[model samples]
Target chain A: MHKIALIFGHNDYTFEIEKNIKSHYKKIYIFNLDGQSVSKDSNGYEIEAFDLSEDWDELRDSVNIDECEAFCILEDMSKNIFLTLSLRETFKNLKIVALSQDKESTDKLILAGASKILPTTQTTANIIVEMLKKPMITEVLHNILYEKSNVKIAQIIVKNAQYFDGLFASDINWSKDYNITLLSVIDENGDTEFIYSAKAKHQQIKNGYQFVVVGFERDIIEFEKLIGGADE
Target chain B: MLKSLLLDAAYKINTSKNYTKTKHFFYNLLENSNYKYKKVFDFFMIALIFSSVFILIREVKSHVNDELLFYNNYVVSVIFLIEYLLRFWISGSITEVIIKQSEHDVMFGAEFNLSLALRDIFYQKIRYIISVKAIIDLLAILPFFHELRLLRLFILFRVFKLFRYAKSIQVFTSVVAAKKFEFLTLFIFASIVVFVSSVLIYVMEANNPASPINTLFEAVYWSVVTISTVGYGDITPITEAGRVVAIFVIIAGIAVFSFTTSLIVTAFTEKLDEIKDTKLIDDIAKKREFYLICGYENISKEVAKKLVQNSEVIILEEDEQKAIQAKKDGFFALHYDPGSIESYRKLRINIETQVKAILCLSHSDVENVYTALTVRSFNKDVFILSILKAKANRNKLLFAGVNELLYEKELVGMIAKEFVGKPVAFEAIHALRSNYNGIDMQEIIINERIIESFKAVADLECHKHRIILLGIYKKNKRNFYFNPTYDTSLEVGDYLLLIGNMQFIKEFTDNLHKGK
Candidate 1:
């Protein structure tokens, strides 16, 4: 898959997002709100100025719409929402990720058709800071976020409840036998809970239920194979 | 030897449980604003003072009813007498002074002179008795001594007792009292002007037959009336020389009066801001448990918004505008220097006991670090959470005693990278963390009752409640156990981390409380 990342706006957040996801994309184009008419090169990536008023015809001409994903991260919140709405309108199936300033803007960006809204708010920061107070959870989250560690978080859908042999979810020795930690379970109704939670403990493995697990990629793959393929 | 025995008996009585309890009860009723019944007592005393003074005022015009006069002259006087005696009693502990002096004499192996201790104690009592408040209290009870015609005049002092009940009047008096030097200068200047002008007027106008000012006393009164700008036409100067002296006196009067007015106005203006800040601090201190936010930045504002709905939150910002803005936004905020430790002390934040957490969320990394450090200095165990605005300042924040750090840029970048390809996972994580989709992550603790009701994690029935429990945090080990066996028994003091819709979480916790 030749993945292309179309990032809108240039600011502090734009740089970090581009830098981190640069390797995943075949080509990355940064649409600068203040860019000159001609395309400029910034750190080996192309930065082209584009007007929000334009119909985005130049964007479609420059990149393959099917293979590209849009990032709406304009510093101004209203502009970010406008860009998300424009991108969603032009490309019916484009995966648009938006950076929202707060809860109110998050709702606005969602209504503007952002596929995923990443809240950049002190409230979110406060929640994260609180979670990081736990030493083990902090290390686990840090590994998943910053480092290029082999540890990965993946979701597996249950295809056969018979695999558990009528035993409860807690009956399975996940980490001991499969070397994969069962983080949480999401039912067909989309209600998710930690596998170890009091409510999830005695639950029978039901078909179509998704299990979120964290482990090395090799272990996750092996565990998925043993449990049968996902719902798809 | 007899003196020591007598002193020992007096100390015993002073320290007796009954005596101390009676004294404490009266002290709280009369003086302690924090006492539950203090307001009631103040109201009763104020009403009594007003009625008594009203009776006295009415007595001058017409004869008051005999019954009303009897109550005011006898009952009101008795109450005032009791109040005065209580005030004098709680003013100072004489027995404490004598015992302390005796202890000192023993420590130094010196001769204990009973007379010296007595003299020192006498001065302490005399100081309290001669105080302005004490004098008013004494005069307020003089209606009982109406037999002495002169003492009957002191009944008007009952009105001054109103000053004790009204807090605003006391505050105004204190503010004015703080400008003692300025008031003293004005007094001296006015006295010199009055003397010089009165001497000149008496020498010039006392001989004028058409003038109202004949006696030296009348000339002195005329000069005072003119300098005060009252300008009573009855005391006009007839002589040309006398009129000139009056002109100079009038100009001096304006200067002196204006100076006095400005002095008081300046004092009030200077103290008003301080008074406001102190009041805010006092209001915050009343909260048994509150979150103390160090700054009113965007993040802290968000934090305060979420917490303020369910709990008390106080925002301390160094910038006056930001603090005022926070206040306008309907949060408890005070203009205080967050970076300075004095701000915490000024707020009287009992970090370990009262404050649930201290959040240092200033826009600047330096400010957050300094605030965290200041808070940490006051309490070693207070949970200090700070925002690391820049990546380079992580170590500095950690070293400055921030227990938890939220690096906004790093988290945003990482989340963006992680979810760009997987939309489902992105939505799930976002829902779990932020209010983007109304789902949130919360922690619930298991107590003895919860342990008793549900022996194992499976018994919680989180699935039925539609809430997800992620793991159990063991209290003793301070470690989280993820994906425990279904039969994993719960124990008291274990924290369960759950992720679900807030409504579902509420229902789940409510069910747990119901022990279902």
Candidate 2:
């Protein structure tokens, strides 16, 4: 179970973010930006209020970032950058999903200690690419990602795994071995392609939405289990 | 299991490893599509239908060996028969075999059935004329069946069948037939002019030899050409009386021409211009206010409208060229591919952050999901109403942080039940649709005493103004539930979504505001 911190700007969006996160991570702390017209009544969700202008120490002490698996700032890059820097100083291994307002903010967000800086522009572009390629498959994708009934979109960026490369999708059998399903790929170019390679017994580095996937919440635990077994 | 079996069967019929080969086979055998060679074939058929009949007639009269023409006639007849059979086969008319299909088709069936019948009771019907023409054509080729000489003579009415090849001629004929009584009244008035002109021209041109107008027919011909402005100068009266007649005729010609043209043009141009300008775009900003451009790809038009309920939209379009056209169509347009977060920024999407959410409709699963993903990445808190195009993409977008998901197809289907049949629903909704082009159809609930009395939601929205109530989609979900009465009382925020013409919709809104 990843301990994640989600900081959002709007009520509805915050509510949705929480709902999305609840499926993937058992523990999540959501913080909403102050002074927006959104409220509990207007927005369909309860937003955990937080001031963006708060001192770094105050924010850290308030949110407790030291123990989190990931810190996601679903807001403008400048604010996200501040949060990333604040969180990085306390927890160096913490993965950050820092939302970038524009492409210009990406490099700075990374420099500010974000492990993952998802620029809004790139996400939207990759979305379009995915839609154009497999036009109607997004419905199935949404069913898994948004609904808490069974699945979640989790990412384990291929790194330091010699055995991970050159394996077909079917052969991966992540569901059987690790209780996860590979939904799509997000390539290095910010392009997204759906992973429908049922015959694919091998996998390669294909950057796109095709690499992103729906998997059981326990898949990450399964991954950690394998890691523990390897260590022993 | 049944669904899978059907899908497998459909897949076997349609899909192929080599698409080109499959396409060719289907194109030649099933489709019989004349797409690539349309222009060439259309002209060829036009020439063949008329020229062949002409040749057959002339050749048989000259006694220049009849079998070829007869054989050609039968071959063309067989082709028509085959074509008609294919049309009937594909139309699946058996499935559509209700008692009252097209009267025209039924009439045609009656004529054919009657002509072939031994008693020939079809000859008693008014449509029997068509049967007679077909009979004549059959007779024209009867040399193969050892029929006598009366078979080859084609009547003037038989030429009408060739009019099917002429669209303009068919329109002319139909119009002429419809205005038969009016034409008769016009004929009486025209004849009076003809008679007066004849008498006057006779008195004046009696002294002139070059333009001798001694007869009524010559005078009538001149009168018609001058009045109609055809003015083919084959025959005319040259005397002073003729000049007087010509002036009256020429003026009449211009008047008649203008009258006919005005009537037709005025009747059709209003709807035609509206259709021409009607186009689909994702976004358009009105009055510098941000708006959501909704598409089924990921959004519903209704929800899109709801998302931006009292806000203006700088309608962002997926294509810049489409945006330009939308601009020309009187929309405040912004060009940005909603799927591309970069396009949003590059197109100054954030520059006008005053925009309401770009409600990616959930019904358009792919587009809605993509738009949501991209949009959340940009402004995590922006309200995005997504319409799930299908049930599958719903959860994914919900996870992606879509504010709302409204299914348009399901909505339209649900509303269709309110109508007895498709025709009634279409006619009622057409006004609503027309208002959306450059104009909008928005219905609001008014509690002020200025407007007329209202008990039910429909009364407040549709009863007095008679704007077509598309539905009663409440804003209570977005706001507080002010009007909780399931029976009637519309509270402040509850909206009455009605569709009406632009003028009426505007007037209706203004009245609601004024408390009228």
Candidate 3:
């Protein structure tokens, strides 16, 4: 039930981050540096207008800066770095999370005394949002994230399997017969390739090859019994 | 002859079996006929209606021949009357099916009351006479009753009956029907504007010496003409009050006209989009052979370019701009999500039907797998060629039922590997892959008909066809013979890999089929 403070620049990424992590905190405060009005109740969070160019006395006096968790997500790198420096100077015990627009900004934010730095160059939130849009991906992610799933991703090595050698990747119906997803394979040369991929499609399954599979723990054990393990 | 024909018709109607057959025939003709029969009937009806209209138009002229007009009208009216009678006769009662039962059946025995049956027939006949189509048919024949001058106007309703026959008119009417409320609003607004303007003009110009609008009717006409921006100079308002009113009317006219026009345009464009979507789906379903290319990227574009020469290519691209560009490049492109099963359903993909092969060329391996899985679920036999970007998702895709897998990294690696040791070989491979304007390689399947006319590789007359016999793929043996000997006997199920000019290769393949 800790209070959190979000410092924003004029961009959608700040709003997105606020939306994603809003449920974890008890009281959330969003400060728009450009003096632009941010909707309070729309995102189920409290919003305030503040200018980064001003002194920190007013901000520190307005909010309980000593106990609050701060996040600097300004669109401008310099502005974000300055805000982090100002926040770090005012509240020595405050945990400051700053967003870096690039590699240089990442180094600068670290030097500016941010407790943690999140690099926005790769934009992981966009990837997550996009992945969540697909129903299958959402189910897989939901199982991995929220549910205590029995499914385990395991890499099994093939040994003394006469029926499987020289068989094409497409020839096997792993899901239908064995209830397992054959993810990829590692060859005798220790080079891993996707079985259905062009690189591994022509590669014959030798005795020392390993297959990375995803399935229930019981199914993997059963599959291991059918195709002899790499230890044997 | 006439008396004998009448007696034969009466005797046929009295016979139950013949009556049943006649009823069935008329029912088919009127309601549930086949495509050709329905088309013939519609055309005949449309032609009759138009000819009646033409006769009506001709009757308006002063120098028309009265005798010929009367004869034509009489003949057309009799044909219409006969059609109406047939339609009415076939409009049997609900109990007609029960009445058709054999007399041996106790429910409809020989002792069944004939008076009840007669009453049902009379009731059905009365219902038919009151029906819309029957009334139209009656009106069509009404012009023949020239004794009643008032009934002559009913013939004009035949033109409106044409609305039922034409599909475009039906669509138009439905669109109007859907937007009737909006149209009513506009009509009310326009009526108020016209009324107020007429009243204002009458007040302003009634006593003015220079005003030409004298009567209330003239004022109303002048107001309408001026507001519609079709002002006739004969009825100009010279007074200052009249000029101001004219200005306001003109501005209101422009606003209302543009508003109504935009409303209609919006409705029309929406209808057009609906029609285009339906037509595109219909076209895809009707095509006997076509390739469904998922993802309109660079690789798929190249694949489409190669296939477009000898086949139809339907592209489903998620990117709207790319799909539009693909369409501009002369490919049938649909801006739809490839991973969605709904889009595949819209394309009507079926086994051994419209689609020959599906190329899943999306950059994302997961997306390709999903598309392949959806398509394979619907059609098990269709050739699903997917490109694998990530090596990790390969087996999952294969398990998902992709038929052919093209490894992107492996292809690039192979080419790079060959570049060091065999530069000349690499160049030849590159040339073939590029598929430059002049020389092209095509794979032609040898069917039963082609095998009958086939001889040795030398007797194919490749030189005459401006083609070089590259190799032959033996189907049964599953082996490729590169540059076979002249005496190699051609067999059925052999794939002829020939390299030649694009035009000649097409001609040679076409001739090979024709020679069968």
Candidate 4:
């Protein structure tokens, strides 16, 4: 099981991230770079004060380093860059998700050895605003992203291709038969494309190709069984 | 009967298509800086001014051929004359003034006063004639009369016409003109000092034959030279009284010069922001369609960057620091209060027509609402989108003329709520929403062509295209049918929400366009 660590510095998003992912992780640690001393937040998560200059030995002692993912999201972009650099220097292979303010900083964080960079400026709010223009699309995205509805997005690796043999990837009416939207396909070579993309449409369905589908939990489960595969 | 017939004929001519088109053509050529063709005409005028001035300068040193002189004397002058007339014609509409006056008279049951109407038209033309630009334009044509020496000297005024073509020069002159009151006071003071000093110096040194200052004219010259600190030793004061007067004059000269310098400096400094704002507006107006974003906070900064790829995005920021930051970030930003009507009015943006949309993205809901109302009052039909910070103020923003709003906190919270035990799903959804890996949700509107091309949902063959048909947003019902059935017949005005790679969607749309 993967553990989660949130290192925050005067940012508002850390609490929201922690609140949403709390139940998923067996052990979750909250570290505050801005404050001195330790205290429990309103959510009862203990906040441990941290310094960028440190080697992060205390963090390693509490959580299994190999099974942990860290999020670096400081509102001050310069400080966030420094923290990411420090964390990368301490843990060479750790998965670090860093929040970037803009394009320049996104490149900087990537260079700083962040495993993943979540750009705050370019992606979220702006895309949300664009989606809001179409109220129906916004509702669909809202449900798929946040709401606890039965609808979900899953990636299934096909272990058996008997049902899809001798058929092009687009030949199956997955939505009509299985009540699931087959979004994309990842071949054994790890090439991914939209299922209806010209290149994907011409390719024949084969075993070991991963399919990304979106639908209700029941429909996804039934489709997974029919495809002789499980979630990847 | 003749009077009514003449009035009807005049009104018909005033509203005629050809007549208005001609007026609009000239108006764009002479007045509308935003008009695309205006630049070409301005360049032509500038080239003419340069060539005419060059010929006049050339003639001063050496003899020119009659052919060259003829073109300079007649061709350039004729063009200038035509331009002057066009400018005067467009300066104010005489027909509008007459129509408004007649309408007022009719409403009040007053007798139509032909004399009063003529007087109004006379004053209107006279106002345009007396303007500094008009005077310069009128004088620029005088050079055509090469036979008259006095008129030839007026050709130098043609160089001043450059101000009419170059906007920066106009801005500089307007900045100086803003301090007209201060300069007027200084001018009166300096004149009085010169009058007194010239008289005093003349009375003190004229009787001394040894002194060079003899006549009042010479005394006036001496006073001007001394007060201006030119200090030519030839106009020296031999008597002690004259020396003392000279000393006082020099000191007063320093005071006057310093005051004038400080006044001009202050005026430029005060008008600096206004000049920049005007330039920004002109730049955006040149583009013709732009998103006017209010506030320069993080949300606005991000939105502006994204929107700039597709259209021009201008940010109106009230805070000086934020405005500067926005400019540094490569955005066109005006350091003007977004909540004030004066800011929009001064910008002269035709919100009803040119602005694509207005986005109020300030952190404070109150500020956003105020900005929305200010923009809405300017044009009731402008699409205003605001970011609502507080959920409680949603109705407040809606009431203030926000056509649509994005509640960033609520949206973020929703996304955050889904991170538990569904990390992959959350990631997949976020990735798709952000168009990561080229997957996105696109809305296609069913119009007449689309309806005819695709008779039913089955005809789209969305599965064959590999795009996910999320649902149809029925236009008539204003309702969404999730996972619509294949047999659902297509209808005009409905929106189909599909999720797929942008390339695939483009292919789908292209095929639909081709009626394949």
The most accurate candidate by TM-score is: 4
Clashing pairs in 1: A170-B486, A193-B468, A194-B469, A198-B457, A199-B462
Q: Against the true structure, what is each candidate's TM-score? A: 0.69, 0.41, 0.46, 0.71
Candidate 1, after superposition: displacement of residue B265 in Å? Answer: 3.2
User: lDDT per model, in order?
Assistant: 0.78, 0.48, 0.67, 0.79
- Highest-DockQ candidate: 4
Give one digit per residue, the lDDT tens place, for model 4 in B1-516.
654554566577789999899999999888988889999999999999898888889999899999878888899999999999888888877666666667778999986555676688899899999999999999889877556977888888999999999988998789889999999999998888899999999999999988888999998998888877778877789999999999989999998889988998999999987776677778767667788889988878778777787778878999999999999999988888989999877777778777878888888999998998888776799888888777789999999999877765444434544433444455556667678778878888888887777988999988777788977888678676667788998788888998888888899988877785
Q: Could you give candidate 1's per-residue lDDT for residues B136-255 as a string of tens digits?
A: 988888779765768778887988988899888987998888898889889999999999998999999888788888888897899889888888878889999999998899999999
Ordered by TM-score, highest first, the candidates read: 4, 1, 3, 2
**Which of candidates 1 and 4 is the stronger one according to DockQ?**
4
Native-referenced Cα lDDT, model 2: 0.48
Return the interface RMSD of the candidates, in order shown, one decimal each: 5.0, 22.1, 19.9, 3.4
Q: Pick by lDDT: which candidate is best? A: 4
Clashes in candidate 2: how many?
68
DockQ, every prediction:
0.22, 0.01, 0.01, 0.24
lDDT, model 4: 0.79
Residue B170, model 3: lDDT of 68
